[model samples]
Target: MKNIKIVSLTACLAWMLSLMLFSSCSNDDANAENSGGGPVIESVMPSGYNVDGSMKPLTPVTLVDPKNYYVIHGKGLLTTQKVYFNDFDTYFRPTFVTDTDIIILVDENTPFADASNQLKVVTANGTAIFDLTVAPPVPTFSGFNLINAVEGDEVTIKGKYFLDPVVTLAKTATEPEVPITIVSSSLEQIVVKIPANANHRNLAVTNISGTAVSKEAIGTALYDDKLYGMQWGGPWSGKGVNFDFDGDSYQGEKSWQWVFGGWDGGNWGFDVDMTPYKAMRIAVKGTKNGQVNFSVNGGSNYVIPVTTTWVYIEIPLSALGNPASVTMLTFQESNNDGGNTVLFDDIGFVLK
Candidate 1:
């Protein structure tokens, strides 16, 4: 009986000692897991952060061994974290990559709390924290087209990243695109004034940071000058008044012309010749009774009445017997009784 009691007491003491040792080891392991030096940050959120770039905060911060650890914050143990640049206020989900790297994407439009341009990193354990400098996104431009034009007319230009962009004309040695004052800016479109006398060719968009030129494109071009034909001397000059003949006032005395086969003073009823250039534009101003006939082939047969004042008449080269060799245009009239005087101006020919 005495032996049994001593053996039982000894067994009980051994069991208590083993339990104490196991408990100490377990505590040490737990402390090791929660050490101040948390998991290493492999990489940061947003590969390349730019000044105009955005961010999203409080997102998941993945860990290399995420299954083995948890994240912490003011509230409690968290599975993810939100981090961003100092001046950026965007939100991001921090994802753990490896012992040395993590991935994150900041919410757009959020200014970082700091301008130092630092990328923040939080460990999965929530105790380890660090920062890595991030770079802002580079500005770029694409697609440029000319607007509202024919050859020789000025037009506006359309494209991307036009706000505060360095505008320049491509392939042109002299003509360059000036800077466009952007009233608004976006990711897809930009409106601006291009150089005058622009031609279809390549164009360039640039900034202090970089330059972006377009693939060869066609643009509106400008034209040269226009040409006009010369004026010819005729009875119905293209003007409102004619000075080839003297005055013919029925009550007033005739100056230096004859009237109706009767000598008054001087040359009165006269005819002039026109060159062969297809057609003649005739302008005449005269009294209602001042009748005149257009004769072709040098003969007096068919006559047309001239009654309208300051009226424009077009006589075709074909009417005169299709005179392939027309030379002179004669006007004949017999004023038995006249009412008022007549006038003419600006008789000329235009090239077809």
Candidate 2:
């Protein structure tokens, strides 16, 4: 497959300027170009530069990037009134329309899921449709399972835009990247086998659109199924803490559940050097919607909004008073809805 081109803003402007020049031709020619009864799409190609810094030709395309320009080569397009990709009514300039071509940019807001995968061109007389695919955006690295995984263990990554992803352990100063074996994959998830010679490294995933590197590297979990470095379960006033809640596992084999009442909280004791980490990340959902006061070292409280469905959140260390060490962690029922259960998983710090 050919490399996906990167369209520069300057080149895009140059093309638009050329379109203005095309529109400056005689009115007789414009009248003759717009005389056709129906538009007929011959092909579509990218309007961007090749990977080698050369201009891309008018070769037919199978996939078009969002927010990128492309040339629609067709007949009777001088009277082109509207353009749509995957049923999205994308805008196009009349000056960009000609007898056999319409240069347009794919809208960034076009819906990419569960819709018609075809480009439609409507002219004054009739309409035309062609099979096409709008490429997904870059991968979003949420979190991964088995946070303390070692070589040859299986790890599941949770995120979106994993289309045809290439998974690899990011390269370190001492060694090159180690490619992980894919056990299975989907648009939102990937299960992989940690390869031999693997270290505690971040995973990098790349699809056709772009690449994404995980925030939390392998083996950096404060809690996956259970809390790490747990000297104690809770502060004196906390209640109903479950170490292994099997009802749902957002990241690993289980999830941490807290049943708390008004003014109650769960506290755990640990001694972790927070210098190497940047942010605290977790996937949380509640029996019902609410908020919790999340903190470390009993410092400042960061209000975390919870929902019925799990929402992954990353709180920067600076927001939590930037403690140098973590001796105690706490989560208080701040938005008390009488009493409720909150589920937590993928609980860990983002390695620097």
Candidate 3:
């Protein structure tokens, strides 16, 4: 009899448990019917939405119908939400859904959320609302030309749309890659130093945003050998020779002063103030025997060199080594009897 009682009690308990589960499931079905089965998307959060992810000052979003959107606080129906892009988590992978998308509306410090057509929607039904994209502005370079230049000469570069602060010069067939010194800059102009090995080089502007490259151009030239020339003097006229007549030889029976001052100085001379690379060259002809004399400090005396015929004289002020200012050059009669004539011509300077 006790076994029968135990079995009957166990059966009663199972019957009661089944009744409770069935009642719970019936209640859930009745609630679903009352609420219309799912959250109704009566309105969208952002109305007339258009924004660029790459643009500064990211755009804001709004609700098409604030009352119907079911906003939690100030945000829209899907308000107080999180966005993920490109991955499963919202950490560092933030992506935009098109150039103008909802991702742009997120705060800067918020973690980037993984995004997908399947990952979008209200987090209830997996549905994609917007596409993600990025639009970076294309950079351009202008104002480029090949200037007459030497290998190590310094030069200035001018251009437009150099948005980046730093400038890059790519290596050429004749020169190595180099970066120019950024002295000053503007929207349309940038001033930088030409590197020592810069030649036939390609230029570019760089920053975090993008780079702008200019066509290759030659470096700039500073010094040339054409800085000096020659001229012919009198016997032709009363006026002195202007270093314009290019003659292989010149002859005269009269003494002519090869005035090296003024423009003829080639901007060179001896100086108490130590300067650099100053030189003068005057190829003179004594057609016959003559004495070449030089003086400094106003001709109190003369240092003479007796020459036999035409010869080249290179009077590098550097060789003179800190001589007095206002020096003089004169060719006189070899016998010192006076009236002996000598010719002077072919005046030039070496600039290197």
TM-scores for all predictions: 0.27, 0.65, 0.26
Which has the higher TM-score value, candidate number 1 or candidate number 3? 1
- State the RMSD for candidate 1: 29.0
Tens digits of per-residue lDDT for model 3 on 170-250?
A: 654655557777767765666666666555456777643357765324431111111111132122123333333333332
Q: Which candidate has the top score in TM-score?
A: 2
Backbone clashes in each candidate structure, one number apiece?
Answer: 58, 0, 24
Query: Candidate 1: lDDT of 1?
Result: 4
Better model by TM-score, 1 or 2? 2
User: Per-residue lDDT of 164-205 in model 2, one digit per residue for the tens?
Assistant: 889999876766887889999988999999976654688999
Query: Which stretches in model 2 have alpha-carbon errors above 4 Å?
Result: 1-17, 20-63, 74-96, 105-134, 171-176, 197-199, 234-239, 246-254, 271-275, 282-327, 334-340
* Backbone clashes counted, model 3: 24
Whole-model Cα lDDT of every candidate shown, in order: 0.37, 0.81, 0.35
Ranking by lDDT: 2, 1, 3
Task: Compose the digit string of candidate 1's lDDT tens values, residues 26-52.
Answer: 445643554545443322322221234
Error of model 2, residue 44, in angstroms: 4.9
lDDT minimum window of 10 residues, candidate 2: 19-28
